[model samples]
Target: METKELLKKVKEIELKTRGLTKQVFSGEYHSAFKGRGMTFSEVKNYQFGDDVRSIDWNVTARFNEPFVKVFEEERELSVFLVLDISGSNNFGTRLKSKKELMLEVAAVLAFSAVANNDKIGAIFTTDQVEKYIPPKKGRSHALMILRELILFKPKHTRTQLDIGLKFFRNIVKKRSICFVISDFYDENDFYDALKIANRKHDMVALRLYDPAEKELPNLGLIKMFDAEQGVVKWVNTGSKKVRDNYTEQYEESQQKLHDIFRRSGVDYASLSTEGKYLMELNKLFLTRSR
Candidate 1:
């Protein structure tokens, strides 16, 4: 993208997402995350006065004894956007590409953090740690983050969220609310990494996907390329059986991702490149508020 075009995209995202942050998302964002935030302190044997809702079901099931999750209320907070920049992010059949939607969603969250007077930082990754911007207050810092995001060139084209988590844990010492923005295109076992990160910080997953990812249209025989692997192949999209198989595989992958997050008590939400992100964001905040 040209310099002029990049500036325009940044300005446009600032206008739209920043406006929503102030006009629409500010109230709910505040309500949902007004308090510093919560981080897992530990899980110990359930005591007599422990709240039943705090029971750690998984721990209890594993140990054959009741354990209650303990959380420490944070007094100060930072927001981190751990973004994925794999080659696959360049694919989109919607109004905007997956990369565009990811940036927009990230902008909204960053602006929301700004409005709440919280420090915001970012970690860019594509199978490796690309960059790290330390958390700081001020809209200038936020805008700088947006600017870098627009022009960043990653050295790798694969997705390895585990590396990003390890980098985050190594750098950020305080309890922070982390937003992992990606399509999560990886087979690497990230569960251990995520669980460790969650113990030290509040982790939220923001998944971005494209409509064409789930169901390929019947465009007859067409050439398809593996964005991450750099493999090109021909596919029979016109075959009903092939389409069904594709959809099934996609849905299964989605379900496994959802289950992983939920089992670890991570807040997560998914949005399509062409969907109304504001509505989804509103819903996410509302649910978190409850």
Candidate 2:
């Protein structure tokens, strides 16, 4: 993308996301992810209802009046947007492709994090670590992340969920809210890595999928290609058996993904490319808040 066009896109995304964050998501987001813990913020005159244990004896002695230590939740957070830029993400049968939805989803979360005064970072992967933008707190930094998510070209075309998660675990030592945005299309079972990453970070799975991915229509003869694997095959989609098998396979994968997340004690939700991502995300946020 050209410099001018990229800036325009960044600004456009920023306006929409920032407004939404300020309007709707900020509070939900704040309540959803918790802070590290409470920290002493300041000292104030003691109040009648104040906790007796919170009395600041030194401040009281210095001021010759009762003072109390004030504390607030250390609400700042490091939010990691782990995104998949694999070729398979390019497939969608709706108004927006999986990749497009992924970008928008990342942008919303980025803005929400910024609204809460959190540092946000991004990791773009496609079978390997394509890019890692370290966490930074600022509107400009968030916009830069949105820019990269829009235009980043991956070095590889395959999807390796485990490799990306392992890389994230190694780089981000502190606990963070990690949003793994992918279709969960990897062939390899990444349960071990998922568990390890979850232990280190508050990992959540945002599974993006296209309706077509789950079921095949009765289009007689079709040539299908695996964008990630670079494999091509002809399929008789008109055959009921073939369609049934395809649907079953996709469902099986979905169930397995859900099971893995459940077993690993990770929070996860699914969003279809044809569906409203914001609605699904809002539901997840509310669910987490409760």
Candidate 2 ranges with C-alpha deviation above 4 Å: 40-72
Best by TM-score: 2
Q: What are the RMSD figures for all models against the true structure?
A: 8.5, 3.4
Q: Write the per-residue lDDT of candidate 2 for residues 93-165, one digit (tens) a residue.
A: 9978999888778888988888888999989988899999999998889888888888777889999989999
Shift in Å, residue 14, candidate 2:
2.0
C-alpha positional error of residue 177 in candidate 1 after TM-score superposition, expressed in Å: 0.4
Using lDDT, give the best candidate's number.
2
TM-score of 2: 0.88
**TM-score per candidate:** 0.85, 0.88
Pairs of residues clashing in candidate 2: none
Clashing pairs in 1: none
> Residue 36 deviation, candidate 2, in Å?
2.8
What tens digits encode model 1's per-residue C-alpha lDDT throughout 1-290? 99889888788889988888888785787677655668789999998999999999999999999999999876456889999988999998879999988888889999999888889999999889999999999888998999998899888889999999999999998778899999998978788788899987889888888877888899999999988888999999999999999999999999999888988788888888886777877888999888
Off by over 4 Å in 1: 35-75
